[model samples]
Target: MTTESAAYTADIEAIAQVVAAVEHSQQHKDPDEFLALFHPEAVWTTAGGKVLIGLDAISAFTREVLPAADWDGKVTYEVVHVFFIRPDVAAVKVRQRYLSPGAESEGAPLYVMSRQADGRWLLTACQNTAVATA
Candidate 1:
């Protein structure tokens, strides 16, 4: 494999680790873990249509909601697709699933992540949309 290809694979692995962290944070109801993935100026839109801009606002919202959230079952997030806009930037498509004995629902969240100078990927901009049944 070419050096460039190897680097690309490594980046995808790093990005997938970030996505896995998102899933981990959600399942554990750890808002701090979730918030730690974002950039300081990150922007996020929730499935419920609330838009939060910047780390402070996102932190405020997550802290208020995540811990208070009640879930009967488990949640999982998968990185379905990754589109690299540049060497240091990636647009990631994630499949989010909420599974329970009573019902199952899904969310499609698009997360834009950036690679920092320190070689860690952080969520930059994101939107979460619920899948609707017709």
Candidate 2:
């Protein structure tokens, strides 16, 4: 593979890991592990527009919500447009589809992500709209 192709492959894999982390945390309800995917100072917006800042908030929020989640699903990154803001700092805009619990349904949940200093992607915002189809 060419240099560009290899870079593309790496990005794809990284995005896959991001989705997997969300699914895994949801299934296991492990907030500690889930919070590890985010930066210590990360900020997020909930579906209801609640603002959460920092890892502590992330842990608390995930712990509360994951247990109540009826849907254990994945966020497939349909489009991940990336940019390197600085040499070691990068950002991405991802369009994702969140499958319903048991991986059913034709609707997509809204999600936004940001990368941590350790090179991991974390959900910065998420919102679920009514499924477009049954």
Candidate 3:
């Protein structure tokens, strides 16, 4: 295999762990574990367009949102594209899908991003919304 392929694979593994942490936070409502994967200044936005900034906001939002969700679903993260902004930072476009369990079923592709630093990837910002059709 090529060196670039190997490096990209390793990067994806690291990012996948971060995604798992996010899912764990959602399923179990473990704010500390979720926040550990994010920088103190991380930002999160919901599919409906509400903006949340910083660790404090993220923590609060997680607690508020996760429990209220009747969503017994799972997420699969696909790396659409990655642009290395620097030696330690990259911008990633991802596709996320959630499998719903009940009658009201729907899934959407989200444009999300993360950044790597100190050999770790952290979710810097994300925008989740329904994909528009052309």
Question: In TM-score terms, which candidate is top?
Answer: 1
Best by lDDT: 1
lDDT of 1 by residue, 14-129 (tens): 99999999999999999988999999999999999999999999999999999887675399999999999999999999999998887889999999999999999999999999
Candidate 2's C-alpha runs over 4 A off are: 70-119, 122-134
The deviation in Å at residue 47 for candidate 3 is 0.9
TM-score of 2: 0.60
Which residue window of length 10 is worst by lDDT in model 3? Answer: 103-112
- On residues 20-111, what C-alpha lDDT tens digit does candidate 3 reach at each position? 66666655656677678767787777777888898889788877776677767454555566666653566666656555664343334232
lDDT measured at residue 35 in model 1 versus the true structure, 0 to 100: 91
Question: Which portions of model 3 miss their true places by more than 4 Å?
Answer: 1-6, 73-75, 102-117, 132-134
Off by over 4 Å in 1: none
- Give the TM-score (vs. native) of candidate 3: 0.70
C-alpha RMSD for every candidate:
0.9, 4.5, 3.4
Q: At residue 15, what lDDT does model 2 achieve?
A: 59
User: Candidate 3: which pairs clash?
Assistant: none
TM-score of each: 0.97, 0.60, 0.70
The Cα local distance difference test for each model comes to 0.95, 0.60, 0.65
Q: Which structure is stronger by TM-score: 1 or 3?
A: 1
